[model samples]
Target: MPDHAISGWAVVLGQLAYLLSGTFPDGPLAGAALTLWMAVLGCAGATVLGVGVAVLLDQAPAPLARAIRALLAGLRAIPVLMLIFWAYFLLPMLAGVHVGEVQTVVLALALIGAAYTAQVMEAGFAAIGQGQRNAALALGMTPLQALWLVVLPRTLRAMLPSLGNVWVSLAKDTSLAYIVGVVELSTVATQVNGRSVGYAAQVFAAVALLYFFICVWIESVAALLLAATRSRQRRPLWRYVTLTAFRLARTPARPPPTSASRGSSRSRPAPP
Candidate 1:
């Protein structure tokens, strides 16, 4: 039984190696390398663009906010795969410009990610208390200063968990690049399976495991951050208690006025 198990395992490993080597070569640069690079670039570009959009949405006035909301809604309603296909096919004809499949995927992902980010940030901004802004203003800070120094930091803290979730969502969304011929992990896995006909299950299983590992890592980090934030929150409770006590201690005592000072009648004073 052990020997049989070992034989089965060897076959699986051999198949995996054959699929990988056939799909991507062992060199300084290869298909796997390109796929990873594209994924990283796509993810990073999306993040930066998304943050910018969020900032814009947070600062927009009512009318502009409505317009932006409508725009984002439309974008979000469209599927990412459809967006990629449209961009891949129509962009060149419309603008007389062309880009490779990976570039097209990155652009599409960034645009979609930015729309979602803006929405998330809008919620975060709305969640902040007005008293915080008022206090900042009372402290002689300008509107922008209040936003930057007080509102932004707090909003970011509040949004970190959501942002991490969004990032995981984006990572999964990268698999959609396969539709546009961008050789990301999913695409490479598909190619491997195509070449190794009987090993599709194993190939896809391995790919899924890889994605699971990535998500687990992200979640672990998020949990650590949340724990730290909780600790910070506990610390502030003590500070608040101390501050309240100090205010109580500094309150002044007043003396009662004498009966003569209370009298308002000039006639009584003359008689005295």
Candidate 2:
């Protein structure tokens, strides 16, 4: 690189501290730290809400289950940007409660994340099916016990990757907070680029790199957790899945009773 280019790059790199901290020492968190905080808070709230709602969807009455499913589908259909807009602009007017920009963004992300998480969890539950729950009940477990001990663990393990992906997506969505002027990483980069008009490419590149690093770190942590969970399980996930498929395949389906068989069984049905 030429000396002038190197000098410009060095000047741009020097703004890294500002991009990360963004008035943190003087004020509250504003840059990458704020983004991460939003993502974490959002994901935590989403996971809790999603799990509760998913369980309710599974166990609720058919009418109520359909309503809950419809609500989730509608929430998922809306864009995250629209959610943010609603939370920021309409929430105060409707609810008469004040919400800071950061809080508003986190709330929007949480709601949307919950919708997706619920969907993933619902699929996981369906995949495991009622057989596991029935087996657990047969072993003297109560309904709640069967859910907690037998069903939730397997479902969560199965859905971990999907959940992690949702979280990663949420982390990326934090960039949208910039639209509300929350001063997250992308916003900070924009500000830096505005000041150094000559180094726009470098500024954006750094921002992308920072986001990439955060997401990769999240994925790595998820992978480690998944590996640890697998080690603790009775069998690896793939083996368990393969064995389950074989069991299901080998189980014979009972034929429907013919008229003669039905008539004979009906006539000879009473035990001595």
Candidate 3:
């Protein structure tokens, strides 16, 4: 029992070192940079595309809206792991273009993330009041101008928290890159465990902590941005108040005296 315990501890320490340092002989950054970069690019691209889709969907007619919703629902039903596998094995065959594991993973993640983001943004767009758009239109603004200046700002402000949630989900989904053998943090931990022989617990613990730190940092940044947006919204309230007061002050003290009133009674008698 003592020997078994000692061997187990040794394995745990070895795996822990590997997990901390990554599987590559050189270091964590050396092996992990490519995967991390891919994930970042995928998330950014997906967010942009998702926003576009949301804007388009918001403008779509009822029939089109129903179609788009159905399509996105189908996409959401597909598992991320299955998507990654399909992309890895079949994309090259279908397109006659080969890609590395990192590329495959990134593509799969981008598709999945975009679907989720689009749904979230659609809800955000729905939450915006129609009165805001009407007010913009009444100001002599075109439809596009109303959407860009008034609708988008309010929608994005409301969507910030949901967007933050999508980002967190994207971060976790990065681990799914392991399916295609992209050496992300999870992949690195898996490799380390394979080598260390039964130290999965320690390796996984370290990986989980790393992911937690990343998510916490992201949440902090999102919170700061939300506060800044709220501050900007409040500033507009004060401006509106100031403008209303100025208009009230500038209102004519009284209507201009009628021109006929300026004529004296003597001039009126001469005319008679």
Best by lDDT: 2
Report how far residue 25 has shifted in candidate 2, in Å. 1.3
Could you estimate the TM-score for every candidate?
0.72, 0.83, 0.74
Scored by lDDT, model 3 comes in at 0.73
Error of 1 at 119 (Å): 1.2
After superposition, the stretches of candidate 1 with alpha carbons farther than 4 Å from their true spots are 1-12, 15-36, 220-272
By TM-score, the candidates rank as 2, 3, 1
| Native-referenced Cα lDDT, model 1 | 0.70
Candidates in order have lDDT scores of 0.70, 0.86, 0.73
| Clashes found in each candidate (C-alpha, N, C closer than 3 A) | 0, 0, 0
lDDT string for model 1 (102-190, tens) is 78877887788778777777788789978999997886667776776667667767887887787677667777877866666676677
Deviation in Å, model 3, residue 224 alpha carbon: 2.8
Which pairs of residues collide in candidate 1?
none
Worst 10 residues of 1 by lDDT: 24-33
For model 1, state the Cα shift of residue 245 in Å.
Answer: 31
Q: Where is the poorest 10-residue window by lDDT in model 3?
A: 27-36
Tens digit per residue, CA lDDT, model 2, 100-132: 899999899999999999999999999999999
